[model samples]
Target: MQLTTFTDYGLRMLMYLAAQPEQQCSVREVADHYGISRNHLVKVAHRLSQLGFIDSTKGRGGGIRLSGEPASMRLGDIVLKLEPNMHIVECFDKSTNCCAITAICKAKDFFRQANQAFIDVLNKYTLSDTIVSGKSFLEIFALPQPTNPDRHKQS
Candidate 1:
């Protein structure tokens, strides 16, 4: 029941943005802070922007910021958008299912219920609810402060 790296990083990006609601951040900055691949963060950022989770701007002084209030961003909704598919087993996807026992598999129903329960739990939380103190996070990562501290409100 592990999430894909794409979803993991997407959540990280959202959390980071939510922690500093008014400041624009670059993918490179986030990648460095999390010790993750910049290339991957770039893809995640692009997809998040396309999905309307974040606003992206280009050229000088341009960066990315959360598009809406973090309190309104449902974790389950974000995961659904970031995940390619929720199918946990071959039987879950009828189009390409080749499982011999697909017709009578009790495991399929169990997995479906498990997956739904997982999402239902996630739906209980929002991006704001997941934020930790930004100061401690930055200090632990040894990342520099946002140039304009006054620009953003800390969660």
Candidate 2:
């Protein structure tokens, strides 16, 4: 039930952005912060932007920011969008299923139930829910926490 490295990067990027919703961050900055490959992050950023998860600006002073409120974005939906494949087993994808017991594979139903349960848990949470402490996150990341005056009002 492990997420792909690409999805991991996407999540990381989102977390970093979540911490600084008011500020735009460069893909290089995020990669450097996480000590990951900037090239890979660039691709992730581009995909996230294309998927409408993040907004990107080109040229000087240009960077990226979350497209909408973090609390409104569900984790399950985000994972589904970021992950290219959610099929846990070969039988899940009927188009290329090679399992011999496809007709009466009892285990397939169990796997499907388990997978649904996993997503159900994720669906219960939102991007904002990941940040347990905003101040601590900003302190650790050395990012300035911009004062969102209307933050209290949003709740």
Candidate 3:
């Protein structure tokens, strides 16, 4: 199932925030780094904040940040909240199902299972999981690299 642009931008915003846990990130910063629409990102940020996924503050020195630890934010849970419809087939939604064979079509069951499987895999991962190779991820945003706590000791 293809995710909508809304979901894509939301996930990008989350990933960017997850990578910069120590500071408040602006919507413009995130949007500029990704070369996406800042206007669109604003809507996603508002929804994310409303959903308690991120915290937002306005005015001077104000921006957005993840409300929870990245490790605790499951990818599947985020997707479920951001994605309006998860139906993989036309028959999935009873109200919208117009396919004649929906009643007898075993295809619905198969598609349902496929959709669940997709979510199950995502459930196994968290926002932190997405930033596993965070050095590269950080570089993309032109943000300062996180100083390794053990760096001084190593030297």
In order, what is each prediction's RMSD in angstroms? Answer: 8.4, 10.0, 10.1
TM-score of each: 0.87, 0.87, 0.87
Lowest summed lDDT over 10 consecutive residues: which window, candidate 2? 145-154
The residue-by-residue lDDT of candidate 3 on 29-141, one tens digit each, is 99888777799899999999999999999999999999989999999999999985898787878898899987688878888889888889999999999996656787856
Candidate 1 C-alpha lDDT tens digits along 1-155: 88997899999999998888899988899988886779989999999999999999998888899999999999999999998688888888888999998888788888999998998999999998887665554565675544555433546
What's model 2's TM-score? Answer: 0.87
Question: Which ranking of candidates, highest lDDT first?
Answer: 1, 3, 2
lDDT of 3: 0.88
Q: Write the per-residue lDDT of candidate 2 for residues 16-71, one digit (tens) a residue.
A: 89988889989999987776779989999999999999999999999999999989
Question: Which pairs of residues clash in candidate 2, taking residues 3 or more apart in a chain or in different chains?
Answer: none
lDDT of 3 at 40: 86
Quick one: RMSD of model 2? Answer: 10.0
Query: Any idea how many clashes model 2 has?
Result: 0
